[model samples]
Target: MKAFCEEYNIKGGIWNDSNFRAILEATMYLPVTDKDYRKWLNFFFENCSYNQLLFNRIQLNEGTENKMFSDRDLVVQRLEAKLLRYTDAKECETEYCLKLTSVFERLDLLFNNSWKKDVLDLITRLPHEQYNQDEINKKLSFIYSNEDCDDVLVQIKELLGLYDFETAKSENKSEIRELLKYPHYYKVLVITGTTGSGKTFFVNRYIKYCLEKLKIRDISIIPYVFDISKVVSDSNLEQLLIHEMADLLGKSVQSLEDASKLLSYLPIKICFVIENIHLIIDEKSKWNSLISCINRFSRYEEFKWLLTINGYEYYALEDISNFLQRYCIEKNSLLNISKKRLAIFQHAVNMDELNKEWHVVETILQKTLSGRMSNTYVDVNKGITTPLEALYFRECIEGEEWVSSPSTYYEFIKKIFDWKANKLAECNSTTVQSTVLVIVDCVIEKLNCVIKDSELNKSDLSCLRSVQLLSSTITICKENFSVSYGFQQISYRIRVFPYWAAIMVKNRFRSKEFKVESITGYPAELKEWLIPCYIFYNAQNENALLSLFPALKKASLLEYALFCAQRDSSVFSKALYNFIIKNVDYIKSSKRCYSVFYFVFYCPLRISQKFKLFTSIAGKVKEFNLLNLYSRVFKSVVHTSKKLKQLKKNMLELAPCDVLDINYINGYETGEVFMHLSNNEEKSFDIVINDIIAYIREHESILEIIKNGNNSSFFDFFIRKCMENYLKSKKKI
Candidate 1:
């Protein structure tokens, strides 16, 4: 092989002389008289492992004859021993070892075909020394045999049972055996109770008992735990269950269609524990589909089903009475464990005792209501003296008097139980408004901010505040402002007050404009936050704007343009035109107002006709005989306008020149000005004009500017001059 590989440019070698010899010996037994057999032998000798070759030879012997092969049995036993030795060498975890042992058990079941005596002897000698002898003997008693019962098949069954129990517990072995023995009895089990009634616990315990006590392992049964909570959408419950089963079994479930295709191939004897069956039951159309699927499972001789639900007897059982009767009653295929099971559960949780410890009951209730509990407050009438009548009452006892009662602690337990029951009952019917109120209250308390629900306007602020409050209520808001908002909304409308007062109280000290800027972007940030409050105040009182002091001061010239853009886009355009015309002299005289105008007009009005107006005004200012200040201001304004137009095009497309829009514009313009000053880039009027045209084309919403018949040609002339000046500047550069 090495010489041939060298000649053909291939690398090949064999290691372990004993393994090579084992492959050679195994290949000799492959009935190699035929060409195909001889070719297979050659391939085996060339590449197969010694253990694989030995296994193949043993399988061939087993397949050659109908009778059980002793050689095959001995080889399998040796393979099992080898696997045990390998596991021992690594000191594998128990789960790992059990997986290896399961493979051996499967092989023995397939190849070791013999009487009970031989199987029992093999089982007794297996390396899994943890086999329960008593359970094995009990399983052996069930294996039928003729005169002086052949112990081989009986022993094999016992061994298999013991192996399966040690490897992985079987959940529905007893149910299957009972069904097989008493086919006339109903096999269906319908378990129902109130929420937190321990139905799931009872079913799990029953499954555990069968796996430990009966030792009827190797029963191909799958216990599927189906949570109906996920079935809210239009998903097929059957396909979902099958997919879940495949996932738990570590098998491929590519799609719902694929899951359906694999369902029939699944082992017939299986237990499906369908939890929260009410989800399907309530959707009548879906209930029909679910029933159809269940009927199919019932038709299989070995299939068993278990359903768990809360208050299922309320509607589900009644709705599906006919279907339930046919399968559960006539077919002896259903079992109703709701009532009897509840009694058993009551015993488990000790609910029968009236004198339970408050702490113990509280812990259990808390666990049961995980992710569902809400902090709720009930108003109490002044005349009501009993605890039950009091808003914070513990059960029926008066809050003050309850603590003095002999059963005070028990009363607390009863109160929690009653509260939990009421909460669960209200989950579906609670109004959106009431729910929002509850959530907002909790959020406010958590944030240490006092808030009253009545103070908030439901129609205006409810939608936004409710979402923020609920998110905060869930303990997801870790930021300081978010927490403060929750507290303020719940306790008081701080954002509604004058910006200065709100800031002073909110920041817990004297809050300057600069300080406010540090916390919330620039003046625009404070202005935007005040808009909603202003709108709310305006809606209530027309002169509400008078109450807004800091907001008025914080509203820079640019923000004023934006505020008009939001409230009146037409007014915003006109105001922007006048502001640019008035500021042209100042911007051209010095760079002080140039930055402010660049931010207001060039940035916000990039897509508006206001850009043309600003450029035209700047050109007029530069043309007029003022002083050297006019030239300097015009240069600064023109330079900054070029960069501002470019920055605006990139950041804002068809941006509304409103306060909100200008806030984003301000940030972009600031960055652009910084970049220009740092890079010392020369500016061109043509470049600036072209940038504005490009921005206009991108934001087609502003194309109306070109169509406006009044002074349309004047706008064109203004842009043409700017473009000419820009191209001239570019040539110089």
Candidate 2:
């Protein structure tokens, strides 16, 4: 076989009885750096297709058909000997060189069918809160017995329930078992719950239990569970179910009709679990046909169905299934734990002996502690229900040390932000540091959402629960700015903020901000930490802009700047405006000047300051010929009619050459008034006659330039370029 294989350029000789042990020993002794040996090893794998060739070569005794492997099992024995030799050699370099021991162990597991032990150990060690170990073991056993089924592989991995924590649902499981025992009594069992209420988890556990019960009863039951969310197309569901049934029952199903026939004729029982049924529940015709098909197969005691639906759509499904109401055996709504039970569960989680869930919490408190807890803040008598809520209340009570020294305070707040980010990253996932940074970005997004909602006076605290953020009324600004002229009214939701978020803002204001370029690259893992620091900052401070790092001057960084500076508010001032104006060239070259332009209008400035800020911006706009700047002014500039009139009066006082730069801006702003004059497109601009006359009279000097045709471009811009858009809207009517 060696000579034949060599001539044919094949590697069959490695598996031959005469060469198996010899090749194993040769590879074991060979150096990893040896080019010829590496080539030979690669060639062996290329020809062998893993352990298949070796398995086929092992001779077996006759009538030992069900035995998974041959009695000789020389391949595993030789591999084991080679592994022992490598480990016993006591040489670190050689250990690295011949690291094929893992491969050999895998081969051994396959031959001896001992992979189940490793799987069981993994299931046992998995976070108990996320998955039930016994249910997982049962699932693995069933999958192991039916390994030939294509869906079994995916089912095994999903049953392990990694990447998600599991909530206890023993009550739901017990109810499901009672219904599943009498399969003939109910054609379908529907598990209903809100999204994330453990409906799918409950159904998965129920299916495992039913499969185990069937095994005990000596009934041939094949379980096929599919999450409808994974189904991509309209027809994919029917085809996948058909294919899975065919594979499970060892029969052919060319179509739905074929599958129905196979189910009818098959004497064996089958359990089918379908999750996220709400996805297709709204399809009246499709849902009716699907139900009819299930009803057809329900004629036999061999078929049983378990379906899950989102509770929000439970009423919709009730309407759709009016005809099949009698066949529906159970409609169980999975619910969150009650407040009393929640307290018990949280206490259990905190005191968990296996995982030591509270060990990390204790570590965080130690690292971030700056002061002793205060009785006024820490209400010891307040019974904390959840572990997370307890942590929140603990932090609220244990206020940070108020350092009289600036440097110490800066360091203290920075440590707090770092600790919060790191702790949140740990709680979310066991991701490496590189990936943890990326996940922390969700903090910024959540913070932005909270700030946006706060601006609209619609900030609701419930949304912050997932991120462990709490919202309290914070008076960031002492003075109450009027909300007239499109300025956001100061919201009462500002004062009390997430403890972690307040630390981040404090750090930013103290000139200890994190590198946006460095931190922004990491995935946003936590939401509470990402809350915008600018939202709670002392916006009234004139030195706020100066305190910001140069790296944060970019558009993306400025996007986090809240537009809270109204006329009387001191969020932005002349000093900051002048500082930004000095960097006009840098600002113009950058793609994001909108934030700068946004600051100009979003900030409340005197009519004189508004013109001064515009003049500085308009100077660069003229130099760079920045047309978008003028367009944005029309689109975004917010002001009262009085302020608008004052600005018009100021512009009219300028020379024709000076006014030329702002002509398009004034034209667009004036034209927009006519656009919104009436809801009906056909309505004449007669309603805003007084306003238009006032605008024309205020800027008569600019209009004079247009009338004389001295600057024909300015006249054509307002009438043809700007006013033409409103004309087009009228034509559409």
Candidate 3:
């Protein structure tokens, strides 16, 4: 600061000049000092990313847009004229030549990063700036993450072709975009996928493709996306559409005629996006009203609809007209793990997991990037024994576990009860202790007990959504990535987490409230099979479960049970094994031996069953190709795990525990960890867990991911990793 000012002979201190932005801006161009330059650059990158860059691009110079900086001298001339208008030009060049060169060198690295690429990409977009800058950014903000290596629109086809869309239904999964522009089959495109399946992410990527990359240039493609999940439930669909369109156009619209007239005045066609259509489809009136509005809008050439629906609710819409159904894309939850998906997910959750994220990304590409598979299983009831079943388990694991799979994110929706949510909406109305208690009440109590779909069928949840891995934010401290992370809320919809989270929550708290005795009546979830399945699979003994929900031939109960086994493998394994044994005669007579064998193959068995089941199935094993099933199950497990070897190396860097807590552990036969093969010494993790218990006991920001994330839900995963690390250190492998 002193050198530049002294050399320039300025009269005032740093804070003396209120209008020194251009001076500061020019200083950013030059490396004033080694440490100072990095600090400024980090601030510049963080602050200027999407908000202020476009505005400055125009303010820097107007005529430069048309004139080519054909020579290096010309760019320098322009920079001098705009950035140093108040300073003497001859002195600027002569005095700061070395500093100027360093600035140019640093700019090279910046351009190679996404910001400069975004500018260059926008420049190439032809029709001479016909695209509105705000609208373009508005669309990109939803789906665009610079973290994605393959940000191009065509990368979406790699994800689309791997699903059960109408195009791939009669055939195999292929890499193709559902909204085909060449054949012009695009109209009211309904992208359907399970909860954890990435629908909104894919839709936004496709939107970006349409806005900036789509090559059909004869007509201007105007794209608009709205998350109507909050407002769509009770509101009139027709009036709401017009109201939204009115707001977009900045005009008053009282009727459909007014909206149609406004849209018709515009030259370009509107690709209007409606998100979370699943919210309304459950109500026959709302779904029919939406479909009817689409029918009406199809008559007008002003706008077209692109809607998203959850797969849990999509099955009810199967009876819609064939023409519209052809455009319906059933998102395959099977084959997806892009370089972009992994990077964005890692950022969103702040989960680098031993910094092996990209290594896992590469492995996934080799497996699914080119070759395609049939994605058939939707829910977990499909059993873990068959090839498709194994594929389903691999693709559908939820939360941080599914971080490596294809991720389709839309809104980083506010948890209805987070401190941040309260800060933004209500302001100091809720305390941190109350927030954690709220989560415990909502997740552990509300969820673990007899929860029905009818209870959840309200317009909005009184509590935050609990069935997901918590969302995270990156913290900056004038250096490389920081270890500190912030979480929005903890949730687990990566397979609805119907299996593990339910079982884990019950055992961690050890509540009789969730016991099998409370299984007095089933909820509407029996139709959906997620919530009821979660409750039923939690039975301590086999009799309560078998008596409550039996695996009838075509009934959904068996599917629910299989889902439990696949997700909550350790807990469900013994119960499923006993149930399967009890129903062995019925299963054999019904030709359901394949599902039984699948359970035997992957699920953890009681030591007694492990030996006895092998003896009982010994004759049938040869007839059923059980050897091949064993190979497939293990192969799928290896594929889903993100390089366990590297993770094991990093997970247990902390000192090995002398005592391990039973509640914090899984996959063990008993509530104990042996130090040696002789089982003479037992390790206890009380020392390790006590610190966290103390923190959670004393800390008020207990559920806040930034303050107490280390002791939050992820601690369980951390313990599991540490256990693996400890096992590796002991050469247990």
lDDT at residue 619 of model 2 (Cα atoms): 52
Q: Write the per-residue lDDT of candidate 1 for residues 340-368, one digit (tens) a residue.
A: 33232221122112112223233333333
Top lDDT hit: 2
Better of 1 and 2 by lDDT: 2
Question: What range of 10 consecutive residues in model 2 has the weakest lDDT sum?
Answer: 346-355
Runs in model 1 with CA error above 4 Å? 1-187, 210-220, 232-235, 250-268, 312-315, 329-407, 414-733
Q: Residue 382: error of model 1 in Å?
A: 29
Candidate 1, residue 288: Cα displacement in angstroms equals: 2.9
Better of 2 and 3 by lDDT: 2
In order of appearance, the predictions have TM-scores of 0.26, 0.29, 0.30
The most accurate candidate by TM-score is 3
Ranking by TM-score: 3, 2, 1
The global C-alpha lDDT for each of the candidates, from Candidate 1 onward, is 0.36, 0.41, 0.37
Q: Compared with the true structure, what per-residue lDDT tens digits does model 2 show for residues 1-733?
A: 5433332222234323223322332334321212332354456546654576454564322223212122222222332332232222221222322222332222222222222323333343335543464675567556544232224434545665642234435554444333333221344556654322335434444443333333343223334565554554545555766776665545567875565444423223455767656555535555655665565555444455667654434555546443334355421111112343322122111122211322433333333343542212122222222223224433443543311111112222244445445544544433333322222233443433223333321222222221233222323433357454443332212211234445445544245455444323323322222323443355465554455434345433433342222334555555456556576555543233444554565456554555555655555556555555555554454223333345445543222434464655655554454344333344554533445456656666756766675553333344444346656866998
Candidate 1: count the clashes.
Answer: 28
